[model samples]
Target: MDKDARDFINEYIASLPWLTIIESVNDTLVEDNYVGKIVIQSFKGDVEIMITIPQDFPLKGIQFMCIGITGYPHLMPNGLLCLNVAPAGNLAGELQEHFSKLRTWMMDYYESGKQDAHFEYYIFDADPKITFVFEEDGQKTRPAHCCGRFSYTSLRQQEISDERVWLVTGIGDTPSRFSATFMSFHQPTYEGLYFLLSRPPMINVNQGLTEYEDLLLLLTEEQKGYFFSTAASISIRSGYQTGCIVIVGYEIPSLQSGLQELRWEPFFISLQEYPLKRDPITDEIIVRPSSVSRIHWCKGINASYERMFGRGRLCSELTSSKILVMGVGAVGSQLAHSLVRGGCRYIDISDSDKIEPGNICRSAYTFVKTDIPKVQELFNQLVGISPHLEMQFNIAIEPILDSNKGYEKLKMYFSKYDFIFDCTTNKHLSIMLDGMQLPGRIINLSISNMARHMVVITGVSQIHVLKNRIYNKISPDKREPFYPETGCWSPTFEASNSDIAAPLHYVINELNYRLEKQLIIASFMIVREEMNHSLAYELTYDL
Candidate 1:
């Protein structure tokens, strides 16, 4: 042990009058190895406390534990007393404050019998090697008992370690794959059973079931029949492994609104050993009468659309809106990503440009490979972000603009979407799209040379009117544009991702607000970044 840690421990032992140290650090039977532990009688009766100062000393707080108690509100199965307490200036003051907090925690446990009403969950003793992910909405009602199947895409090792990890995509009655246009869905999936109970099946107040026979006993007669019947009917394919997962769900009251929410706990079992056996008379396999197979409780990851994608509050319009982004360039790609991240499900992206090396600095395209189309790479990225996102990518929109009878095709195609955004910054294309006077709402989004301002023109469909408004409202670039390639004549604007993201986020927030409020009118909106780093929004209406 370090000299500082030893001095602190000596100081703590001498200062704390309330705690009587029964076993000192010199005792080998208690904790022999490291800085050693001081077992003290800090609480009322029968509950001993073990205090150990970490190597970092006062920098990292001390560790405390109840010697032999389990299944309390704040106590872990191994009797680790989990308390969040701040440290003091000196070791003496720190020890006193920690002991005070421990006393308070013990008092609360003894008096109220529960420390936190909202977070008190049953602890199951099982391995977390396998995990099952499912969707959960706080208020969604589910069947009392049902068989569910969930599809998983891949099993790969974690980056830092060789530990295997599984990613479950979609969960339903029949297994479904995560939809993606760019990626194939040929991965393996598993079928599982679920039971909904009034409350969690527990061995004690806070300890959950850990054995298959115990779980069967906890279930109702009807539920037990359902389990046996399903287990018996389960067919083990010739080459496949015989195993399945069982998820137990129960309602727990939320302390905030006093409403009940579903809590799910999964347990995996090998069918060859559990809920299945060979008959005594005939050598045929049958459902087992009783078995003491251990329940392998898995870690549950909530991968529901609402839980994963909902950014706190989601607008219904954004979720259901069919958005068409005209270009997947810098501004366009970021806008498309923002829309997807903000809960827009159905989006179509159109672009003719390939992802260049220079585009990586400002755009969302992370790949540096040559000749990959912008729409293609962007589609892959969006699919990675949200697999359930419904998106279609057109390699080039310029050809459709030039093809014979293309205007009619454009009109027909554009009419299918609810909102069309011209992020191409191509004046001719924007004018043509606006002049088409398509059924859907047309909004043109463009940024200034240095990302100083962003423009959004909504509701105007006339060619001349949109042209005049754009010429009048949009100003010339103050800073000069540079060519990305040495000899290439394509002069693009200069701005980092941070510079563009600030204004783009402002524009997106305003767009969502206007969309939700049904205030998307024939108006011009400008989002300008001030010298003070605050965004200033200006909205003007058409005459």
Candidate 2:
């Protein structure tokens, strides 16, 4: 470091009471040597402390570890301070700034008599939709483990400190994949998405017990050590009344490596004042003394789409296929849900209309929005099911269908998807798209009166040819399939979701194979099903 910088640090040290400079190599920050060390006698004793110049001083921040006390109240096992919660940040401040924190921490630690500090317990993750049933007389059980690392306990009080710990149950350590902060829950009966998860009470969070008597057992000594540690938080629904114990507590840090060279391990603790509190001054946390709290900990199952269906080959492949869906009414919206369930992650939905009172029974959105665009509504609905799903949608199907409204350039944009589904049943728009040299495979899907029969036409410019083949006419009535529902121009197809969905699903299964390797194959799918059901009659033609 610069000589002036070192000189400033030394001058500051001389002013500190009970703190004396033992030695300073001026050249090495010591005279004679280009590299040297600085030793200081502190409150601990003559051998009180030493700040390691890990690299050139001022050029690199100083690192310090007492040659004495190790772990809690004193220092970590490696003798270093635990300020680096995740990892020690590069210390760049002047000597006074860094050393002052060390001094205050050491003095407080000494005054407190090295009492044990508490941390929060981090459960790997849990499910949202399913309710874990807890028996009045606990019996069934499983095995799990509490992972590594330590935490700082100096600042918070004995009873109300906001520390964190963790437990991973089920098969093992959650396969070590990158996990998100939280998991959302969904259920068929529930009409909306939610984030609340409830599970059974722990059978045993008792000390010296290797496993949690609840659903799973903790495997390691680190976990066992943590089992003995107490955890405290404001009780929401504990005791025999709620049956479900909500181990609510303060905020926990992201799980990562412990401070520098020491591992803190997990533990159980008791609670006094509420663990979570917002401070007004330094906004720092203040906790009252509370004993260690203990109860059995359990890991909930993760039921995400990727976790549930990623093992299948078709599901794996389809997730990577980019599907562009135009007109998300009854058919398109249902198709989007099916695709997401089949692990189709990349998708785009576009619709020119909004949901209306009459469209509720057939559309995908379970709830009603006053005048929200159809695409945005479907986009948010799909994301609620699978957080990993990547999709985008728009409300410009009308503009793209009109030549004067920039329809000619729209084909270039639509051509990027691997498969394009036109559920709009718009004959003019389908015919216009047929004339373009699209990069993606275009499949024009339409269901006739009451959904008694349906047709899916694939390949560029084949919409007319397939219709001719299916209807047996060179030019059939352009509006032969639709009839007025409410007004002259507004025609509605009476097919129910199952009536249209069954045939569309079968065709999609075939297209999954046909769309591979840039194949230019043209085909037609014709199907007629029962009024009460589907899959009655189906045929495919390759032309």
Model 1 compared with the native: what TM-score? 0.79
Model 1 over residues 257-309: C-alpha lDDT tens digits?
65666667876667666764546798444446675366778777665565666
| lDDT, each prediction | 0.65, 0.49
By summed lDDT, which 10 consecutive residues of candidate 1 come out lowest?
A: 231-240
Clashing pairs in 1: none
Give me candidate 2's TM-score against the actual structure: 0.47
- Give me the candidate number with maximum TM-score: 1
Predicted candidate 1: what Cα RMSD to the true structure? 5.1
